[model samples]
Target: MKTARIIDILPQCYSLFLPPFFKNPIPIESAATCRNCAMLEKPDSHVHAPKFFSAKTKCCTHHPDIPNYLVGALMNSDDPEHETGRQRMLNRIAGKTSISPLGVFRPKKFTLLSRNSNLEYFGRSEFLRCPFHDDEGFCTVMPYWDAVCSTWFCKHDAGEEGWRFWRTLRTYLENLQKILSRYVLLKMDFKPSISGLSIDVSAPLTLQELDDLPPPEPIYRKSWGAWAGNETEFYKQAYTLIRQLSQDEFARIEGIEQKLLLRELEQAYGLLTTTPLPERLKKNPELNIEKISESSYLLSGYSPFDPLKISKRLYDCLDFFDGSLTNQQVIRLCHDQHEVGLPEEILKKLHRFRILIAVGETK
Candidate 1:
């Protein structure tokens, strides 16, 4: 049996390596592959999923199975000519992001990873088509992993940000792995675990040994507690770390985080505003981009109101409306003066509204 290796130590050292601005991370493989992760909205009640999985889930577990080709590219560092990500990354850096040290060291789902760090068991949703993925469906960078990312995969959480988010995850894991490796050697006096494990901090680390560590909790898939309970708290720490960095270091990490946040926010925010599928459909729906495309808008946690409120109000209002109501009329119904309420303009944009003007002219 092959031994397990974990970058339990690396996150500490390389926390500064990550950019600030706090983009969510994507999984390495299928979201379901992660025995530790969960699918929100109760994708399924299968015992392996996070607490949110419900039997009513209709999301089919078909996250385009990634063949060895894409995996091979990710596993190796053979940067291909078509690797548009390099440019994309640079462009994002030039855009809204600054190079700042992000507070990325917060731990997630310690219990799950601690119990099972099996790399082979990632979810299919975790597998993805990277934005940089070519028509051939292969990553441009086929080599040179920082190590941790080469081995991580997702639990196929429906909430997972697409592969674009994985870039930072890849970097974070790589750096984390390095930190864990060094710490393990120091702790073990420079020796591998008895099973010749690639890495093993399984020696039962104490909070003391892991001191100076941020108190982080696990979030299912790429989803997190966007409320003051978790999201704000988590972002606070992340920004705090970035703020401490010198301009150059902050810029470096911030640039990467900006790209990550934008792509992830695309999905999260979209879900926030769009009409959540019928309750039955949400319980058992096709999760392909095609199916998801029908949704009108992406509402993000960034909205002033509770993300679910907009969705709930939309659903409740839909129930009150006759299907015959014009789209504009429906939008008007959703409009509210309360700051927490959805505005017609913003709602229209969020739902990707299609306005049709009646054309009657003297011909």
Candidate 2:
């Protein structure tokens, strides 16, 4: 396997914040296939197979919080590719729709509805569709997308291991974004009023709040304080301030929680890239299997969106993995009894996806 670097998995916008040491390309997620989406339904698939996302939506369902620096970057970019995203940001600022000095937010109504429905709206509801998702089914803010958008993949190449790493990375980046945005506000001598700026969703929304309503003028003004009218300029300046922060300065701003999260992210990344096979394995009892053909079966336990395909011969070999035998023993037993030789790579994949579990482990 090729060695992966920190720069490979991170968003390009991080180049402004991260030190110069991080510079290398990592493996791209070929499995997710964004341009020609892999999540679309196939005509000949079995009825029991997982349904695909709509072509129009295709997992662009959740709204993301674009930090002040990113908002500024998008607004100030000169690249023609960024024009559509820039205009979208400008429109949001002009209309004062979910706009704050700190960042753009997911609207309260959508947030409430998503929460109320327990995120059943995810990948299914157009009502929760992202503002930056365009008619062409592309994200206008691609390179400058937020942590959540950047880190999430509908299907992972390393399966559950990949999912875990990205999820942890997303949390770490989110915390960093929050810290940096607030730091910029303080450095600009603007004291942010958290109560005034943050949406209060502890109580259910009123009927009026179910619309795309901006915050009341007085509260919005209170949140901005000194930078009330010059929101765009403030974001631009925020971008400049954040861009100039040295690695040491950045570290100084990070608290213990952030530090810990960074450590966890690194560990998760390592595990994702170098997933070790267990000594002994057993089949995951929860896997839902459907025979796709006389020779093949579809295994759907790793993820609801992506299923693993296995041959009927290999499916029969699963019974040998009762956790009592070592990996080599199981392989030898299968080869001797059924004349079926299991590949090391395929066994690793099965373990990664939890289709096969370690002897003492529970998922």
Best by TM-score, which number?
2
Q: Which candidate ranks first by lDDT, i.e. highest?
A: 2
- State the weakest 10-residue window (summed lDDT) of model 2: 19-28
lDDT against true structure, model 1: 0.31
* Candidate 2 ranges with C-alpha deviation above 4 Å: 1-4, 8-13, 16-26, 44-47, 118-120, 194-197, 206-208
Residue 75 in model 1: lDDT: 25
Relative to the unseen true structure, what is the Cα RMSD of model 2? 2.3
| TM-score of each predicted structure versus truth | 0.23, 0.92
TM-score of 1: 0.23
Tens-digit lDDT string for candidate 2 (1-363): 344666656555566556443453344566888887777777765666666777778799888888888888787788898788888888888777777777987777777778778554667677778888888888998767788997888887788888888799789889988888888877877764543255787877654455656667876687777777788998888888887887788778878888888779778867876888989999988887888889988887678777888888899999999888899999998899889988899899888878898877765
Q: Report the C-alpha lDDT of model 1 over 47-166, residue by residue, as the tens digit.
A: 322224222221222121111112222322235563464444334223311111121221222322434645322222232223233333333332322333343333212222222233
The count of residue-pair clashes in candidate 1 stands at: 64
